[model samples]
Target: MPQHSPLDLAEGDPFGPHNLPYGVFTTSDEPQRRRVGVRYGAYVLDVHALAEAAGSAHAAVLSAGTLNPLLAAGRAIWSAVRAELVDALTDPARRVTVEPLLVPLADVALHLPFDVADYVDFYASEHHASNVGQIFRPNGDALTPNWKHLPIGYHGRAGTVVVSGTPVVRPAGQRKAPADAAPTFGPSQRLDIEAELGFVVGTPSTLGEPVPLDAFADHVFGVTLLNDWSARDIQAWEYVPLGPFLGKSFATSVSAWVTPLDALAHARTAPPRRDVPLLPYLDDSAAAEPGGFDIRLEVAINGHVVSRPPFSAMYWTAAQQLAHMTVNGASLRTGDLFASGTISGPRPEERGCLLELTWSGRDPVELPTGKRTFLEDGDEVTITAWAPGPDGVRVGLGEVTGKITGR
Candidate 1:
């Protein structure tokens, strides 16, 4: 029997030719040199090697140690590179040339694909915001007054962002309970995970020019699974007058693979209905393309499936977030990352975070190991997601996982 080609992906494999998510990896033999690669089934394609072998024009950018160079190459170059990759992988004549560069995924070490220029986290889910509001202010309205108008977000520390599987050190900060006389400082008692999707910017905008809603695709390159680790105890104490600080800055984990926007054409869907009218810049009701994605996210702890958050149910779309983010003339950067905050649906099983699922420790979630209100020292949290692809295939977004370790 003829041997199976390394590119011969199994039927319905999430990381098939249709979903060639980009990442950076290094083999053990050359651990110091990081090469840009595309995930193909169970292997990582050495894009730089393939480009050099094929004498492709994109060889220079693909030779970079990180994705930043490719990201700065703009949308046209991105499309050309992706098309070349697909053709090279699918065409049988090139199999001999390509097969040599295919490295088994397990034999390589994945690193942060891009050096994050800036980080912003948005609260775009009505269900998640409402649940959080109800938990903290039971007597007040679930949705805030401005919730329906704009995407609420906060700038985060970019230096702390790590690749998936990196150990998350439990953050230590000051905390004050409702009945406490004074604040205390120590390791956070209520560590939590926020399942989110991060949008990566490829092309940048002018420093003083606001990017309109229609320009989202022109700038955004791809999406990644992001786990926004939160220290609820520290956040609660410090987020009164201002927003999240040390509670959130300690660590944020993202997937190694970044699924490009071009592969998600079939996943676009209309966002949830807006209760209030949006301004011209933020409006997308009459846009040519749907802004929201139909990605389905699953959150698991210690091998136990817990919640499934639907990205389609998010009130605000990524396009809207980009528009709002730049409305005040904030310039975009090649490696800038903006995240879709905890994606939750209306159902109880759709809650995205432990704070919502367990209701601020009032309700403990029962797991095979034991009950968990917040993440424990050794607890490992994993978030994986998939979106619809052409011909009914599933496009997989790489999973972001981190294990909690006491400081």
Candidate 2:
């Protein structure tokens, strides 16, 4: 829990020695070959150098330009590497060897840490789900019949998943207004942002076997901030029998750094009690323990802070989602990502997206420059998260940010 380190880290630095989150980076000087790096203060440690100097096999695995290789290596190697890095950073004698390899974060360009295998997005937050259900289905009950029994999710577009800072082109799709007799195709007018937390799957599982709740830490390598972009007008017309498609598949932004499950030891907390009994397969025993994280997630537009969604407010846990995902005999592959969709708390200010915050575009959110019901062209949306670190410092998941540009 000590905050002491050989590096000149600030007292409340999010990427202090306590948090050696992994990332993929390439500098302006060396842009051809991507290398694995770890965030420490304002510098990124060249993990390839750490691998090479130690002559560890982890070097070749981590040096593959993506975190996928190291992810497949599983928990044992992950623990070993993290421990070794912590020791190296803490050791005064090792400073000389480590200093030469440290690259200032300002000089490097961060890329997506891993190649996505499959993407699944789950609507796990009770507050967010309720808000959405009420707005969309005003005459019907807020929650669906089977909502409490299982974690509801759908497969997302893995091919469209982009790293932070990527420009989100406004999607041109079909939309029919209430008064319109026919649907029209054009650029989306109701573009929005969904603040989310993404779980990165590391180890692959058998095709017929399900990943149990206990295997969450073993299967899921790390967590990252995610922004699931939405086109409301396109979605409202198409989402009748089926769920989100072109309205959502446009672009989903993810943070550059992946904060390992090992670093989030202190952030665990219990979720709210379930009102209904879950099926045996979905009834994870980890629920008796603290299955939720106390991560404070924020959604911002332009330069204004709009909402603060708490991750702990989710109805279902991440472990439960993982268990339900593979319970149908579907296998997990390395780089498989599953996101906790739109984390929202009980308060009005805790809404995760503009849909809820503006009440389905009925109310406009007041800002310094102007009021907004939804994102306008050239609007930049940023999502960031942080939790209590080892000491008084905070451990950040970094930010997933993107700008809306006209097609």
Candidate 1 lDDT tens digits, 1-407: 99888989889999988899999999999999999999999999999999999899989989999999999999999999999999999999999999999999999999999999999999999999999999988999998899988999999999999999999999999999999999999999999999999999999999989999999999999999999999999999999788999999999999999999999999999998887998888889899989989999999999899999999999999999999999999999999999999989999899999999999999999999999999999999999999999999999997999999988
Backbone collisions counted per model: 0, 0
Q: How high is each candidate's TM-score? A: 0.99, 0.97
The candidate that achieves the highest lDDT relative to the unseen native structure = 1
Query: Candidate 1: where are CA atoms >4 Å away?
Result: none
For candidate 2, report its TM-score. Answer: 0.97
| Worst lDDT 10-window in candidate 1 | 272-281
Give each prediction's root-mean-square deviation over alpha carbons.
Answer: 0.7, 2.6
The residue pairs that clash in candidate 2, if any, are none
